[model samples]
Target: MEIFLQQLINGVTLGSIYGLIAIGYTMVFGIIGMVNFAHGDVFMVSTFIALIAFLALTQILGATSLPFCFIAVLIGAMVLTSLWSYMIERLAYRRLRGSFRLAPLISAIGMSIFLSNLVYVLQGPRNKSMPPLFNDVIQVTQGGGYDVTLSVKQILIVAVTALLLAGFWLLVQKTSLGRAQRACEQDSRMAALLGIDVDRTISLTFVIGAALAAVAGVLYMLYYGVVNSSDGFIPGVKAFTAAVLGGIGSLPGAVLGGLLIGLIETFWSAYFSSDYKDVAAFSILAVTLIFMPSGLFGRPDVEKV
Candidate 1:
């Protein structure tokens, strides 16, 4: 029971990171019906951006407040990463929108490769490490010769994720922009006909997705204390799996899927072989695809006559 409790805390913390990235995947798919394969790399870029911002804050500006530095880095990463994704949408995806389906997919793959290689060339293939923060812990329970504890970082990750999700939900449900996004998701042509500016809506969708991914990147760096140029692929793939498992077009489903994946990986490593943790998570994806293709919250597509 103690082991289970400890793994649960770790799983939820990891899952929060995956959930944030998964939101990006679901949002892009919901709006344009294309997986932004470059999203994970966008996340990778955000981490580097955060790293640079942190260095500038500490080394260059001599900032003492960790909280202020973290906030500045988070905002900087979000704004810059959003700009990067907006440009990617314009340069790589926008023109391919009307082309064949595979065209955009291939373009996304190419962009992913380009991003990974670009980061490798610029940042090198080595892992970048940071001084750890928020190391304090709260003892949850003591029993059965074991102590279950929760770290401050875990608390912050969960709290921030909840707040972001609430704000994002409100953005999607109660605003004119949300209405426009919904209209685009239903029918871009119809939305355009109604003077909705489909192009701008799509661009904003990419921007929003990238911004969320940026938050995930920052949180991930804080949790793990290290990052690499190639870090994006695995997490990106896992988040993509989460998106698919939860029903790609459903926002809440994406988050739920993320939590499930996180818990599965953590527990599998705790009880089973750690070498197969990735396998365990992927197995869930495969099973979901085989039995529940529409996912837990996703609606099946209805063909228009």
Candidate 2:
């Protein structure tokens, strides 16, 4: 039970990160009805940007305060990643719009390859390590030769996830921009006919999705203390799995799915075999997809002929 609790705590922290990235996947798919094959690469790029920002803050400017350095890196990465996201939409995706669906998908996959290789070329296919932040751990309980511990980083992850989720819900649910996005999601042609600016809404969607991915990237780097050019694929796929499992078009469902995937991976690693943890997650994803294609919160779309 102690180990269970410990794994649960760790799972929630990891799940929060997955939830952050999964929200990006869900948001993009919800609005555009396309799986962003390059979304994960965008996340990888943001992490590199965050790493560089941290170096600039700590090494160049001698920022010794962990909190200040973290804040600056997070904000800097968010801004730059949003710009990257915007450029991607404009350069790679915008022209493909209104074309055959496969055209955009192929473009997204090509962009993903381009980004991974671009980073590999620039940063040289090596793992970049950052100074560890939030090393403090508190033992919540001591039991039969096993101790349950909670780290400061875990607290920060959970808290930040909660805050971001709340802020985003407000943004999507209560704002005029959100209404416009919703309208576009429902019907882009009608949205444009109603003067909602479909193109701008799509761009904003990409920007917002990238900003969220930036947050996930920063937090992921902080948690792991190391990153590589190829770091985006697994997490990105897992996040997509989370989006699909929870209902690709549902925000709340994405969060739920992330949490479940995290828990499943952690518990399987703790109780069973670590090597098969990913297999378990993938198996669940496959099973869910086969059995419940619409997902828990997703509804099928039926268009009139």
Candidate 3:
């Protein structure tokens, strides 16, 4: 039971991180009706940015205040990745906005390929390790004498995720900008008719989503202490699945979806075998799709043709 609880906590922490990335995907799809395939690569880029910043700062500042340094690097990566997302929208996707849906999908794929190749050329497909930001571990002794261990980094991940999710909830539920976003998602034409800047809203959606992805990247690197240029691929796919699991456009759904996936993966690995983890995950995905095609939180999208 203690082991189960420990695993569940671990799963929740990991799931929250995945939820962050999944929110980015779902937000873009909800508002723009296109999947940004390059998003995962954007995550990879941000992680590299944080890793570089950490290394450089450590060399210059001697790594005394590791927490502050980590926060600063994460913030910088978020801003840069946000800008990159905006650029992707402007350079690649904006042109195909009102065209056939396939147009933007192709553009997304092309951007994904471009980012991957660009990273490979620049970073040379090497796996880079980042120093762990915190070394402190938390241990809890259960009534039955089982020791439960938790890393400071894991706690940080969960805390930061919760804070960010709260902020996101406020942004989406209370802010005027979020209303515009929701309006755009529901009906771009109607949003435009009502004087909303649909294009700018879409760009902002990309920026916000990318920023969250960057945060996820930082947490991921800190959690694993290593990152590769191709690291985002599997996680990205899983995040997308989470997005679909929770409800493609629903914010709460994304979180729920991510946590569910994380739990499933962790339990499968623990009980069965790591070798079959992926198979188990995809099998669950297939079952979910077969039974609940609209996802647990997804409402049927009504289209006016």
Q: What are the Cα lDDT values of the candidates?
A: 0.91, 0.90, 0.87
State the displacement of the C-alpha of residue 215, model 1, in Å, after optimal TM-score superposition: 0.6
Tens-place lDDT digits, model 3, residues 42-65: 888888888888887788767768
Count steric clashes of candidate 1. Answer: 0
| Per-model TM values vs. the true structure | 0.98, 0.97, 0.95
Q: Which residue ranges in model 1 land beyond 4 Å of their true spot?
A: none
lDDT of 1 by residue, 1-305 (tens): 99999999999999989999999999899888898999989999999988989999999999999999989998999999999999999999999987988999899999999998998999898999999999999999965699999999999989988988899999999999989998999889999999999999999999889999999999998999899999998899889889988998999999998998899899999999999999988888898888988888888866689
TM-score of candidate 1 to 2 decimals: 0.98
Tell me the deviation in Å of residue 86 in model 3: 0.9
Models ranked on lDDT:
1, 2, 3
Ranking under TM-score, best-scoring first?
1, 2, 3
C-alpha lDDT of residue 22 in model 2? 91
How many clashes in each structure?
0, 0, 0
